[model samples]
Target chain A: MKYRFNTSTMSEWKIAVLFLGYVLATILAPTTAAENILNEESARSASEQQKLGAYLTRAGNCMGCHTAQGGQPFAGGRRLSTSFGIFVTPNITPDKEAGIGSWSEEDFWQALHQGKSRDGRLLYPAFPYTEYTKVTRQDANAIFAYLQSLPAVSQINPPSDIRFPYNFRPLLSIWRALYFKQGIYTPDQSKSAEWNRGAYLVQGLGHCNACHTNRNLLGASEEDTLTGGRIMGVNWYAPSLISRLEVSSGDWTIEEITELLATGISKRAVASGPMATIIRQSLQHLSIEDIRAMAVYLKSIAENNNDDTSGTLVPVISENMKEQFAQGRKLYDTYCQECHGVSGEGVAGIYPPLAGNRSVIMASPLNTIRTVLNGGFPATTAANPRPYGMPPFQQILRDGEIALVVSFIRNAWGNSGSWVTALEVDRSKSGER
Target chain B: MMHFILLITFLLITPVANAAKSVPDTIAERVKACTICHDNEDKIERHAYYPRIAGKPQDYLFNQLRHFRDGRRHYQPMAILLENMSDKYMLEIAGYFSTLPLSFPPPEQVSIQPDEIKLAKQLIHSGYPARDIPACSACHGDTLMGIAPSIPGLLGLSRAYITAQFGSWRNGGSMRGQVSTCMSEIAKKLTDDEVNAVTKWLAAQPVSTQPGSISVLSPALTNRCSNIVLGEHTK
Candidate 1:
């Protein structure tokens, strides 16, 4: 009880001991998969099997992918398009024909690891064998067990529509040879158990890089380009997740982040659009450990310092804008000045101002015009638990009136969005984009 | 083990039992038209976004409708078609949706690039060691099964949606209250390749990524309110 230890000395001793233990373990650790497992007949219990199913759910992101564009949750057929091509997801029900009902656990493993079908034919790489190949056969088998336990439903599989060379299935095998490596998720024994857990989910199940990482012309992701991935046909740009590379949030705690991912609702931001579905269907069902793992891993990226919040497009006071200012000012004063302040700050959580919003002056202005005419909404997050949306003015406002409203907001206050015509709104509504 | 099962069973049934209390004695006047598209047993196939609503948490579903009403989440069809809706009616709709049992359909197997998978996995498993990208599983879960009431499941999400979201965060998209915007911060730290790699890996993973319910820590992860992109809703 009277022992006293110096902080520096204690730290030095701990470091030395850790290094010694690492060196010792490195030489004594088993060399291969064969050396790891002593038995093959072990079966997961009902409880274990259920937990295993939960594990597989996180690993596969089942609800996020399998759910159709507007179809049943986890029922496949959401069309995904990339520079390479488009692929429609398949169903996972136990149906003998339409679903994976006929496949064995071995077949499931093959498809995941080797990208090969139950009959031995190569499966398309879109199935994510690249990452899944890292999962252990034991884990894969557990997922299979969970699948077998579900009720079977018959839903016909859909064919893909990727263009030309992208349509070639055999070519994926060639690609696999270069990238796919079959094995269990290996934990870096040198790292902490927490770090290892993070690795398991990110690499094995969460698959965060698939969206955050940038790809080359051949659709290969470049290492340095992580968190800077290419944007698809939509005007959407995937942000970087490497905090060392950039910072995207003004402030976010580890716990706040986990809660956001779990419920799609947090004090900072609410999940919206496609992400809403992902949260409601996919991440929300994840276990507390997995949520923590995701949070821990994301928090580890705190070094990134890129904040493009007020990047550009803040409406400048220009000669032309000055010229149109009078007309626009009169319009605003007559129609909008009553509820909206002359400064256009807008009511909190009720009316959003155009001052510093990128979405307002975005290159594509559909959301703006549409919002003006149709009056859409924001999603529910903890910050603004109950939001008040704007009502559509299509019935009350004429086309020119809508145009004037849009143009004013686009250029008003600090807003820098370009002028928009009623015709542009009409074009967008007609599906030109 | 029995206790766990019993607890879950009770959790599942308690909400429905409470829902039954709200029904009016006059069955005809208190119509259940909402059940047509919101039933737990039926398969909603017309549109994939229309999630099967049965068996969901009543509070969660109600929050969504209120979100739609508040204009945080858009639902043109709902407002234009169901405008004049009362707060009570919206809550009623949410109650009906919370009764559906989750049913997963078969998955479609697609192909992908090997090199893409390679880079994606590298980032996913360990993150960019050179840059400090944390693994995705830290918060989402190793199994990715979400906890109850508030947390969402990560299994079976569409890669396109996932990628799009990360893109939104990168490009500075706003979500509810701006609290959950941490993902945007996390995404901002990633390189383009990391996004693509993670998205591709997620899309390609085996179906039903997780097996059963994953525990959740909603209160722990979603309490902050800094980064307010929009102070108020715009008219």
Candidate 2:
């Protein structure tokens, strides 16, 4: 620049330097400001994302099955009893050696979406990845971030005590091939947003089908997810959600379903057994909107025509049957009339009504017989802190006597359900016990 | 026309008489109605929350019935059942239950920790002077078998029932009474831990061989409980 004293050359060089400086400043200044903004935005969103993830985790009730009694939360050692064998839950904490700490977001996503580990190892269905597979990658990443934020607990999970053929990890791949489908939920265009959200939660994070859907011998859920099934090895029936004659029947209002899920008690039913646990741990914590969404979805499930009782012939009460009814009536008067009411119209807020109660009159009389014989207490929850209980008649009533009482409840007070035979009662009682 | 009228009257009167006859008359038969929730007389400990009323003091039982009827207590079923009953009939029922022989099964084997037992023993015998909580034995008698006519024995009741009663008292369930109940006053002074310990220990205790009401009052009760009355006939 000093050598070129000529006016034109000097002006050109000055212009070139000015342009270069302008380019450098223009490129550097906004990037630095943008970096600061990006940092602040990310920091803010990260926490919000974590909060959402925490909510989702609660909705999924991950800690319920993962955390063992007296063990660190999420540092799993709980033994889940199944018909196949006892499966020990693994540590989900962020420990590098014992948990998923070493895993990348992709690895975690693979675990949930494909039921596979970072090393391409197949995961057991007990992890509930089949349902988790419907989870979006963004949501999976958020969950991973939340898990990573937790304190790393180095708890080595006990090895599962599964039987030989089932314990083989390679077999899980074959099982996945048959049963597992890797896909995110595609919202139905025709349904409302609430319904779609409910479907997503029910089919994915809530994993209602894990207990509610009937499973085949191979442990794959049968075609219909809402049709209901027996809980394996537990001898408790998770009644059909779709059937008009079963749980959440056609007569139930959406509000009743919401109330039952939120408070563990409703006009029509109370949450007992496993359902109580689900309400306490999972459903009660959800937002009212989410609960309403679930109710909407549950209500929209079409009533199965097969459940219609119109085609079936009501049995004629023979003289012997009349005698049995009389005997059952006497037993009811002596034991049940005070709380259940003379007409089976139970006292509001104190006792559940037996008159036209779906639980009492469902096609499967397993729960009723078991409830009468063993007596079940309603699940104590925040909403229903002082729930009324039914005392066990196992010690007081014989099998035949239990059968009579159960049959009486089923057939009494304008209810028209199939008769519960003594043999059925005996079988259910023994099986449950 | 007169004969037809007489026949119609007879038909109506006969059905009414039959209905009256079907109603439980004897105290034993009437008490059988209670076994729907309460256990049978012989096996009174079978139900968890239902108290054994078979051998409770006559005055105590009468007062409870009165309280239920008068809305001083709040059990819907009890209130409804006792609503129309005459005071004399309730007293008769109470008298019948009181005279019946008291029988209790062996104390239930509840798994209470040593620390809990220690806390229970402290509260039961010494009382919490710092919190102004009097010893349970002060009013319940040194044997905890209860004093004459009105005080109820704590030994034969279930832990759940005892706890619930204490909880009710603490929650102002006895506020309906014109005078503060002794239970309400005592329950208010106790911490939740103390309540739990006391109930658990009391439920696990073996009822004394002489489980019947005593003639004398507990010596520690310098002040009489206004809510309790020995009823002229019971005395």
Candidate 3:
């Protein structure tokens, strides 16, 4: 008694109608902040508060920025170089003189919420208080408690090396007035609790927007959401999370996205470079439910489309390009074909397939070039303890050779990315920001 | 219109002058200072002071850099230059130097007595077995070119440089191998005359036509020197 009359088409129609209803519901929901709830979160048991603090610290990736190269954890001296200035991270250890030991819970809240230091000096935005301003008072106190629990280490924060006009602190007020907004995440009534939790973490503590959004001339983020752009000074592109043309996970299963968030490698994709650091230090520590929630939110935001991986469009190759292409094929066979297959289908779970990989076919060939030059090492999480590493080719391949091989992969197996040039490779090698 | 766009692009992309002026930031440009001493041209009349770093095995070169940085092998300027470098930076420098392909000039025919040549060859090829000394070929490949990754080649070095190294090893000077200081022990065992003879013969021998270090390492050598592992004992 099965009544099958184009069930797949019917399902698609149903999904579209449901999606439209959800969109309309979201538009009609009134936006409001419950400021009273912020104080209510603080009255937890001391031990429970400590545990939560530690977990939230991992969620926020506090140690990744604060700790210097080969220095003690949170005894901050890490340097971040940007076009605006070179900002040195401050010590957050509980040392009386050098760290945040003297700061009360109220003082900590003022710093996180108001972007002001204990002495009432306007703190630099480099500290990411712009994002931290959205963090709840309870979460801030928990992080503070965790810092208070750590053994004190005395290391004075180095002053940032900013250029003349930026070095003037008072000027930040103007920038803040124009771009900044102060508020905690107010949950949308239309969305589920899971979606709201995901929004809070991603928008506030995770600060995904920092690298994933483009910046304007004054170094303010151009968009509030993750329509990705090139991370200045680092040279890696954080591809858009919402676009079907880019790194959207809308088509991916809930399990696949959750696995990638939890372990840094899923069946479909593997995280590398800056994302690898985040996975190792932050995402891997989070609970499975929270990771799934983030995935759910991300998937919901992804724009719909027919599969970008399927159709094969023939590319125009010039006589000069043909010769270059031949040379690239030879290089690929010699070096890459052993791991990534002859047709660019890499081993599942171990070596990610280049075929249909969004990262490979990305408009900017920066990440592909970088992975080849610096080696692709996914984070060593509990799930994938001994992740197979891609050896760096910088020593073996010259700028031209790297360009050719990278361009070959991008264009092979129905992937239609732009050809990488030797000049771009040279620029990247010279550490061009 | 296209030309105007290109001009704007160039202006926007250019780094601030202060950033560009600070240091020779690229690994390739930064390593230019090394050529001032190493002078890795493979000349017939070689500089006797600095060893040619150009075509040395990468791990061998890497270990030497670490030794200099960590104070195991002391040269004040070398130490200062490498003091703040991370292991990864040192590896990059090593890799950069190791891949520079250069043709070795024929070895300079240093005048030596036939007796001295015989003694030197015996010590290098079949070391004094009674004194528990292994052949140079046991670790450095049969061609006297290095084994891939770690062990350094003994050929194409100046006689003076070779002699100085032996002296440093014997006298408990700055040079110290991390594994066991097996070199220091071997240096102590060899007589000054034996070292002198060995250096003269080594200097006289032709550099291997081989482009890079040989791939295989002998098992006997590995048992003798824990420091010279088969491949990349990076730590």
TM-score of chain B of each: 0.55, 0.79, 0.82
Give per-candidate clash totals.
Answer: 185, 0, 0
Each candidate's iRMS in angstroms? 13.7, 15.2, 15.5
Quote the true-contact fraction of every model.
0.00, 0.00, 0.00
Evaluate residue A83 in candidate 1 and report its C-alpha lDDT on the 0 to 100 scale. Answer: 62
Pairwise lDDT winner, candidates 1 and 3: 3
Give candidate 1 misplaced runs (Cα > 4 Å).
A1-44, A69-75, A81-86, A134-138, A177-192, A214-217, A221-235, A242-250, A302-317, A322-433, B1-235
The TM-score leader among the candidates is: 3
The digit string of per-residue lDDT tens for model 3 on A62-126 reads 99889875467998987888888898889999999999999999999888888889988887777
Top model number, lDDT: 3
Worst 10 residues of 3 chain A by lDDT: A30-39
**What are the RMSD figures for all models against the true structure?**
24.4, 17.8, 16.9
Candidate 2 collision pairs: none
Better of 1 and 2 by DockQ: 2
DockQ, candidate 3, vs. native dimer: 0.03
